[model samples]
Target: MFRNFGKRTEKAPDADTVVPLWPQNGSAAEAEPSAEDRKLSAFLELKSRMHEALIERLNLAVIDKVEPEELRREVASLVGDVLAEENNPLRADEFRRLVDELIDEVLGLGPLEPLLADPGVNDILVNGHKTVFVERAGVLEQTGVRFRDEKHLLRIIDKVVSRVGRRVDESNPWVDARLEDGSRVNAIIRPCAIDGPSLSIRKFSRDPLTLEKLVAGYALNAQAAAFLQALVEARMNILISGGTGSGKTTMLNAISASIDPRSRIVTIEDAAELQLQQAHVVRLETRPPNPAGGGAVSQRDLVRNALRMRPDRIIVGEVRGAESFDMLQAMNTGHDGSMTTVHANSARDALGRIEQMVSMIGMELPLPAIRAQIASGLQIIVQLARLADGQRRVVSISELTGLEGDVITMQDIFIFRRLGKAADGSIAGEFIPTGIRPQCTALLEAAGARFDRAMFLPEEA
Candidate 1:
């Protein structure tokens, strides 16, 4: 049973009638508690009686047919009757809050609904039943929201996984899924999660940031943006490399907007999160095996299949496995404008990672052959990083020129030069030209997407 409600001196004028707490003119006080706060308070009080006979009397099917206002009224009446019978007094605001909370518990994700609705929140981290943390603008802060207990948290996790036709249990204690809104979700429970059931949600932006907006935010300069746009328009094979939470996908999505609308683009991912606005786009997502561990579809299989689909551009969400070989094959074999992301610290490391992934195929291909394939397929690498102050920036832009013996030769056209940290602890840096004009400039010119050669010249020059 839940704990008793704390006593408050203020009481309702009548048990049957509930009035609005805000002023008639619709003015609210600065210190007034939010609707979510009030609902949380009310939920605690009614937690014990949630499954009582009175609550069961309200038919869920009938409730679904009722309008929101009408449903609230019906729920308010029921809550009022329950409170009156208990001989407990509550204010008008408290009565309304109880009704709202009951509805959320029945129809929504309960305590998480408010956090999910907040646009400012970037990520939701549920450590356990009592602790919740939210990332706002890349910085994490503890939130007051909590579940009733471990059981309640598990119930919510089960609800999320089930919606995607997935399950989590003792045998399969971890699951990865995406919300209907495209937010990514990862959950771990029981023995796997030593502390408690852990859930992490990497929320997607409802309104994705554009390249212009990214430039305005100092993620990259105008010259760099123009160069990338030209490269994309010229159908260059590009790979974006970045660390975890470094905005690689966001950068890819923004650059992908430059793709010609008439071109058929196929995007493959483990979970479909890319919001391609193009009219001719096919999104493919990989599937995990069932409880029996059969019928699994991998990204490698999708990449190989996408080639047969006559794709003008193949945009892999990321290449972390044997799919790197297939992606390279597609790019090398008439699939220009292909793009993908990789987890690496720098441009040189990005090539090394791809080589390692290719080696994972267990084939005895010579090192020089692997290097040649990467050199021929990939034209550019855009490396991004999240700075100390939680700001993401395009750190470097390099072109894979060609293979020199066993090594893949590369040259940076642009790089971010870090000056120092500011008083506010933000990293002060400037994106500067590396003074090396890429060999791809000829290709861009041939495609009528040429830019000023001075854009690649050093600032001093």
Candidate 2:
């Protein structure tokens, strides 16, 4: 279940009004003005006037060329001088705050800078310009942030997409991009988005969570962590299966950290997000097609090219298309420790998804043969799930024990058994071993990785 990281208390702003900006250390009366207060209206009007003047005085071309700190200083001085000439009613600190926000509107992601700065916030969702929601500790809450209008939201969206060398016009009204800090961003506008411009941002933490942190957070038991580390060290192919926001990529990153530093690893993704610390890692990202509908570099192409690069391991961020076939081939052909994530409800469904993906390539391979390739290439599947209470945990760890007749056989080595919900609505569960030792334990032993057999023994056993 979700751990309470202490709720962040913020006053929700009015949708129709622009909230007056004040310094953090300003007087409580000035900082927390009520909506009905005449002073609040005056402050907002002054901000609007000052903002326009600052924009006009600013050199847009030079702003992009100068350092951010330098630009901030220059803009601050300009705003201060303009406020003096206009006989601004606000205090010096209030003027400074207004200047900083105006600079953000010009040089940064307008209303999103504050949300992005909040370490507690994990996601920022903008439903047009008038509404914004954020995910904090797996719970969605409406934030007081908003753009001026739909046009303001569209401008921000264009700024994000264009920075990534992508476009989103009437013809292509949807785009996926990454922020400078690796946050995943998706935006849709106009024709596709009937409800004005919509933007969703999945924020990545500056400090990535490690396996130890995950175990401490009860995302998985210590035994399962040790088992995964052993699997990586023994060069076993692994498939991580989870639904959206189930912590699949986080788990993949944590597990991949166990990989040997000397081995060269290649990672492919639509948008590069993995933070693998291995020195020999090669990162590749897919590119969207140009306006001419050409020059697109797909994940499948990257996977194929990774093979010729002589990688010891291949890690695809997620297999969503025909790339599954190429990734499987890489895993089968000597890339023993390769790993990938899949969007699936369970381990069995993950395999089924892979079969469907491979078939999409038009290979016309028999179902049995496809199952065989999957069973042989993948040694384990670690399934993750975000519970009703917003806690992400490893739901199952299944071993791919090869094909039995026409179907692939999998045995669960570890599983999270849900007991019930606690008084706080958090899901209560215990992770326990199934007592059946994985067939790959022999392979792990043969590869010089020692694991305790007692780890496989169930509590009753």
TM-score of 2: 0.88
Candidate 2 wrong stretches, greater than 4 Å: 1-56, 59-70, 85-87
Clashing residue pairs, backbone N/CA/C < 3 A, model 2:
none
lDDT per residue for candidate 1 within 43-66, as digits (tens), equals 674653753534587887676688
Instruction: For candidate 1, list the clashing residue pairs, or say none.
Output: none
What tens digits encode model 2's per-residue C-alpha lDDT throughout 375-438?
8899999999999888999999999887779899999999999999999889998998999999
- Candidates in order have lDDT scores of 0.87, 0.87
lDDT value, residue 80 of candidate 1: 77
Q: Stretches of candidate 1 above 4 Å error?
A: 1-42, 51-74, 84-89
What TM-score does each of the candidates earn? Answer: 0.86, 0.88
